[model samples]
Target: MTIAEGCILVACLLPIACAWIAKSKGFGKPRRDGGFDNHSPRQWLASLQGWQARANAAQLNSFETLPIFIAGVLVAEHQQASQPLLDALAMAFVAARAGYIGAYLADWANTRSILWTLGLACCIAMFFIG
Candidate 1:
């Protein structure tokens, strides 16, 4: 598969991984008070959202990388793209995503948002440039 495809795969898997981790940690299970149910789909979604401050950043980072990946593929297909550049951007995207997740989990709102924007710009740039 192409690097772009691989990056997309990673983007899809990251959220699943986070959800599974949350479930394993008892984030989605029903509460004993009978007022809150954990096993419900809503509960799971809510749990995910509860982690949103962090999860949102991670999601942004993942999606932000998509455009650059797409752009790289398009350029490569046209024989005008540098493999090294694509590799570097891909690596940066992944690293930024990891940092985004960490910052989000830590509730570092400002920094996380800044990083998220950077990644988003990458994707937006690719969409127009490609």
Candidate 2:
């Protein structure tokens, strides 16, 4: 894989790391029935409805965006895209995702959305530019 692809892979893995951290911190638990107990903050966040769902919304939103971005990078590379620009966008996407995760965990609503939007925009730009 190219550097840009590696960067996207890192971005993709961050939330899994966050989920692991959440699980380790008792935010979610593994049930004896060979399934996860979706009962902690993670589940609460995931099941968020109405006005209480923003953080979970943001988390899911980021999850949704990263893959498309990675796919775009892959397509671009296969089609002989501009490597420098793709690399830059990949790095920016990762940075924005990290910011989004941090801000969401901190419950900083405006900042989290801003970061999420930035990442999304980066991905969108890649789709077009790549």
* Candidate number with greatest lDDT: 2
Winning candidate number (TM-score) = 2
**Tens-digit lDDT string for candidate 1 (1-130):** 6565476567556656544443444444456533334447455445444564345445545554555556655665466455555545555655566666767777788877787676565544443332
The regions of model 1 sitting more than 4 angstroms off are 2-4, 27-39, 47-80, 125-130
**TM values, all candidates:** 0.62, 0.72
lDDT tens digits, residue span 15-99, model 2: 6766554444333334543233565455544644433354455446667776788787877777777889888888888898888
Task: Return the number of clashes found in candidate 1.
Answer: 2
| CA lDDT, candidate 1, residue 48 | 48
> Alpha carbon lDDT of residue 82, candidate 2?
88
Query: Residue 123 of candidate 2: its Cα lDDT?
Result: 75
Model 2 segments more than 4 A misplaced: 27-59
In order, what is each prediction's RMSD in angstroms?
4.3, 4.9
lDDT of 1 at 28: 43
As for candidate 2, its clashing pairs are: none
